[model samples]
Target: MEFLFQILVILLAARLLSEVSERVGMPGILGEILAGLLLGLLIVEETETIASVAELGAIFLLFTAGYKEVHIEDLKASSKKAIVATFFQIAAAFIAGFALGRFFGFDFVESLFLAVAFSPTSIGVVVKTLLDMGYLSSKPGSMMLTSAIFDDIIGIFLLSIVVTVGKYNAFPTATQFMLLLGKLVFFVGIMVILGYRVFPYIFNYVQKMHSKESIFAAVVLIALFSAYFAEIMELDAVIGAFIGGVMLSNVAVAKINDIQSKVSGLAYGILVPIFFAHIGMAVELEALNTLGSFTILVVVLALLGKLIGGFVGARAIGFDSYESFIFGSGVMPRAGVELVVISIGREMGIIGEEIFSAVVLMVVVSIIISPIILKFAIQKDKQKNTSVPAS
Candidate 1:
């Protein structure tokens, strides 16, 4: 009963602030985040139940991102560009973070973990922004989405290295690295094969069931199963949910649209809001009182790392100046994987409280600011496109 009441309060606050945020011409996500911040300040400390629900929110959020916004064909088309962009983006962020840590007197292992924490773009945040702004299928959007996925995959590898260093006080052996790589390849191959060859048939049969919302139930089940599977394989649940969504996307059943509609309702109307709000709630605002300069440096370097790296990669791939800017801005947000990495570090007693707080503050700042810049870039590009006369 107490937990239920807490959820009621959270939902009410999140939804109300979201509407207020939209009215003020900011993204509703910002409002939801603010709501959480306020609630955290006034009453709510992070609880296990709320955190679990928030994780579910992230899973459904990514699932919807994959299902409704990003397409497999688009991912394939942008694969090469995304890989290049991701490499540069992660490299820049990692280097900057490591340098910052070292300058702040952290040891080598701590510096490495700090670098790894700030290195990945938050896919859920990017997807939400793109979906909200109707840019998910655009050229930049496709590139951004693919690049973010690559960032997550790289983050997983980096996390393994950092964990090994933290736990065993040594680098992972080549065999361990190769095993992780093999697992990644196997997971992707199996999921892709199943998505293309099996899911459609399953959904077609599911649609014929007399049970009400059976297709919806089946989708939810698959999403949960995929998320659990990913966890067991040492990958993020969002990745599994996303792959499941992509697989279910191609189902050509009669009520496919309806199924998507239901999923969207559940994801956006409920889970996703909680996810964003939870991010805000998790922010250690008081940490900034002592580490103001450190927090600011983290935020600035984190943004610049992705922006400069993304720009160089996109330009190398032949994107023009403005387009390169869009690509850079699109990849600037950090959440999801970064938070998980820092949390793990803290749990393992490697990351001190002060450092953890600084990173958390940085994540919140990046999440709040990056989307606004991306939106501006997107809108500016639209204006430029419209002003030009057709040949």
Candidate 2:
């Protein structure tokens, strides 16, 4: 009964916060996060459950990301440039993050984890912001979108490598990690080829059941089962969720969108808020106010590595300098994805709670800075495009 009551309070609080935030200019997620912070201040223990829900939020979030309309043609069209841009972006971020982690006295595995954390592009913020700003059809927008997708793929691969190779504070024995990688690769390859047959059949069976709840229920099965498969195999559930979503997304594109809508409602309305609030709850918000100079230095350097790597990568592939800045900024919304990564690491005992807290602080700060920078860069470019003196 207490569990039920806590869940109710979390849902109501998250809804209230989201509604209020949306009425103003901010994203509803900002409100949900703040709501979690409020709960942290008032009822701290509830936060652990909330954190669990946040994990659900992450699963649904990534599923929806892969579910949105995408086709082979779309991938084919952008694959060339995306490849060039993403290669350099991952290489640079990984190297820089690893160096910084070691410099901070972390061992090889920890450094690898840090590198993986820095490596991915957050497509959610960039996509939502672009669509909201009515720039979805613009060339830069498409380019950014394509680059972001490739970064996700690269990020997943890097994360799998990090998790398998850098299990604790040392590197995985090459033989063991390589074997794990082989199973993963085999699973992914088989799914990519066979999902076209299996997922469509499964989805069609669900649709014939003739109930809306059935679709959402099917989504739950997919999420939970896929997540479990990874866990039993000694892999992170988020990786399984991502791979599952991507495989089913293309084959069951229509159902994916419908499932995505319902999933989003749940996440935003309840799960996600609980998750982020737990993050804030775990934090003594005041501690952030007093981080040491050296910690601050590490933070700044990490930020610089991302910004420069993103900008240089984008610029290399024909984006103008300012446009490259926008590209990098768009990728900087670091909250949701990083949370998923950190949670898994903690559960596996690969990282302690203290380090987890520090990483969360890093993500929150980055998330705050990313959108503002992205919006500015885009608006500035739009002004430039429109302000030219014509003959």
Candidate number achieving the greatest TM-score relative to the actual structure:
2
- Report lDDT (CA) for all predictions: 0.77, 0.68
lDDT by residue for model 2 (1-391), tens: 7777777776677678877967764556666667666876887465455567767777766655555533446666776876776776667767877787777677777777777776776666557677877876765677678877676667667767777764544676778877888879776776576467777778778878866688778776776677677767666677777777776666553365666777767755566667665555565555555545434644565566667777887888888976887777776666666666666666566755445666666765665677677789888887877886541
What is the C-alpha lDDT profile of model 1 across 1-391, one tens digit per residue? 8788878878889999999977865557767878888898888778899988888887887677567765556556666767887898889889999999999998887888889987888755566677887888987788887786566557666875677667644455788767666766787788888777777778779878999988889889889988888768766576678777766667666237777888889987888788777766766777777778887898889899888988888888888777788888888887656766776676567887667777767776777788788888878887778888653
Error of 2 at 120 (Å): 1.7
Model 2 weakest lDDT span, ten residues long: 289-298
Q: How do all models score by TM-score?
A: 0.78, 0.85
Q: Which stretches of candidate 1 lie over 4 Å from their true place?
A: 79-86, 105-117, 120-171, 314-327, 334-360, 367-391
TM-score of 2: 0.85
lDDT of 2 at 259: 66
Pairs that collide in candidate 1 are none
